[model samples]
Target: MRFATVEEPDGTVRCGVVESGVEGESLLRLPAGTTVLDLIQAGELHAAGERAQAADDAVPLAGLRLLPPLDPPTVRDFVAFEEHVEGVVQSVSGGAGVVPEWYEAPTFYFTNPYALVGAHDDVAVPPGSGLFDFELEVACVVGRDAASPTPDEVDIVGYTILNDWSARDLQRREMKVNLGPAKGKDSATTLGPWLVTADELLPYRDAEGFLALDMRVAVNGVEIGQDLLSNMGWPFEELVAYAGRGTRVRAGDVLGSGTCGNGGCLAELWGRRGAQDPPPLRPGGVVEMTVEGIGTIRNTVVAGVELPPVRPARVRPRTRKRTS
Candidate 1:
């Protein structure tokens, strides 16, 4: 079943299932405050969907505003695609490939879930960001306990497209300090169009059990990158399992399959763009990402609150105390 959150004409937000009719699409509104996360946590998705179907009021899709399926409790993004990681690493490190430790385990980083925006929303580039970029990827919402021996057997609520907006310049500078990507990525992440249940994607699963969905990204209606989800070196199951190893992956948690092969952001394209660095995303630039089985999310870049460039005060060397 496909589900989404919509804004009502009365300035109220509601969760509903996408219903198709002769006139485009409509939303079968569910009970008040019935969010997608609520259904997942209660494991009552099917029952809730049935209830929505019978509701009398069906709002036109075009008239309502869609929100990210939910405000994810925790967001973890992983580097699961080899081609994407390889190209990015080589581009930044002058031909260096994946490190030895990378193959031994599926690695991920926590992102700020509070900044998440739904499909068709406007995203603003953080102030002082010179190389704004977008990452085209897929994300899943956790529904069941991840401690199960067969992680893949856990209930997966649904899948949606993820747009990990980036500040390339800030990322490069901070990561050089041997820390994780923080401020550079904290701005915003785009999710939705709607959520597709796992059962709906069964037909697209390959023999190896990896999804075969094709992911594509375009800026201002011009295609920039495309890749197949089957190209992931580490599947979603592995990533989720690894994440729950010593911690709990509760319901509403989100795990992202990092950028796909050649999902060229300015950083990756810089090496190939020659002396002319690809222009950063400007205000009003539209970025669209589509994934089969899921759907397309188009976002417009807008100007954020501007701030002066970061400047830190110099630190003086201190003398060490002699210990007896």
Candidate 2:
């Protein structure tokens, strides 16, 4: 089943199951104050979904403003694509391949969950970043709560397309300090259209248990990147299990399969463009990403606030005491 959160004409947000009819698309609205996150938390996804479907007063999908399927409790983005890892490593560290540790584990980092926006929301380019870029990825939404989750216990309810919007220049500047990509990436992350259940994608699962779905991204009307989901070195299960190492993997946790191959982002594109930055996205620029089973999410880039210069601490030179 496909699920979505939508804004009504009265400015209230409602959760629903999206259905395709012979005439057009419509939504089976759930009860008020109940959201996609609530259903997942209650562990009543199937039962609640059935009840929502039978209710009357459906809304046309076209008229409502779609929001992020759900705002997860925590967001963990992992680098699962080897090609993307290699390309980005070569671009930033002048290395030829991935780090040894990258092969040992599914490396991930926490991102700002509050920065998330939905399908049609306008993304603001973080201040002072001219080399802004986008990371094309697919994210899995965790469905159940578990501590030290095992592979079998990794209950992923649905999938969504994710745009890990980036400010490359800021990222480069801070990563040199070897501590953060924090402010550089915390500005915006886009997820949406709707969430597609894992069962819906069962046909695309391969013999090795990895998905074989086609993933692609386009800027404006031109295709910029394409790669198969099967290319991932670490699948969603392993990533989620690893994320639950010691902490609890809650019902609304999100685990993202980092950027895909070749043209996933300008960081990788920088190498292809001969060590130069890819054209920076400007106001009015449109970005669209599509995953085979899930849906497409399109967003517009808009102007943001200008940032202030990095503050510097005053340094005082110490007078050496006479050793004699």
Candidate 3:
């Protein structure tokens, strides 16, 4: 069943299950603090259908504002897709060279929960960002905290689409310092429309199920990236196992599946293209990412003003170049 967080006409936010086929369309606004995560954690979803049908009042789906489906306690996006990793490596190194460290473990980065926007929300392109891009990914919402949960013990509460909006210009400038794509990615990340429970998607976890689903991305009605979900080298279970290694993951914590193979704006348009010829997204453009069984997330790009330059720290000069 699909669940959502919505804002009422009086500006109050509440959780609700998306009920279709009702005469007079409306979102059934549950009490406050009743997030999609809470329903899953409490295991109250089994009776969701019954409760939805019995309830008489529902806020109009068209009128209310939709928020991120879950209020994640911690948000981490992982780069687990080999194609995405390879593509990024090739983009940075100008060839198909692999980084030795990437093979050792799954790499991830934290994103601001505050920057998350609901589905259908406008995505603002950060000021002075000329090369904006989108990463189509599936994010897992944790159901319980586990310090080192085994693969079987990992509780994947639900799944939702994530749009990791990127500023390539800022990322390139800061990444040279060997630290991050940090502030470069701070503007915004989009999640939701609805959160589909893990139980509801159990079928898709199988080989045959994976082969049946198609994922696609389009820019202003033009199809850009398309692939089958079966292409992922590491599935969600493996990612959870890798992430749970000696690290505690709590309920409502979000784990992104990174970008799918050929599922990024860069690879979709200009594979192996350099920054000079990078396919930069411009303001007024619309980006849409869609996955089968789930749904689509659409956002329009709005131009932002220039931000002040970030000051760099002083570094000690190297006496000699060290050779490995």
lDDT of prediction 2: 0.87
TM-score for all predictions?
0.93, 0.94, 0.87
What's model 1's TM-score? 0.93
Q: What's the distance in Å from true for residue 277, model 3?
A: 6.7
Off by over 4 Å in 2: 316-324
The global C-alpha lDDT for each of the candidates, from Candidate 1 onward, is 0.82, 0.87, 0.75
Clashing pairs in model 3, backbone N/Cα/C closer than 3 A:
26-60, 27-59
The worst-scoring run of ten residues by lDDT in candidate 3 lies at 268-277
Q: Per-residue lDDT of 131-183 in model 1, one digit per residue for the tens?
A: 88898889988888656335666557788889989887778777888897999
In every candidate, how many clashes are there? 0, 0, 2
Instruction: Report how far off residue 171 is in candidate 3 (Å).
Output: 1.4
Candidate with the larger lDDT of 1 and 2 = 2
Reference-based lDDT, residue 304, model 3:
81
Candidate 3 stretches greater than 4 Å from native? 22-26, 40-50, 93-95, 207-212, 267-278, 312-324
Residue pairs in collision within model 2 = none
User: Residue 101 deviation, candidate 2, in Å?
Assistant: 1.4
In the range 160-190, model 3's lDDT, one tens digit per residue, is 8888888877777777887777767878889
The best candidate by TM-score is: 2
TM-score for candidate 3: 0.87
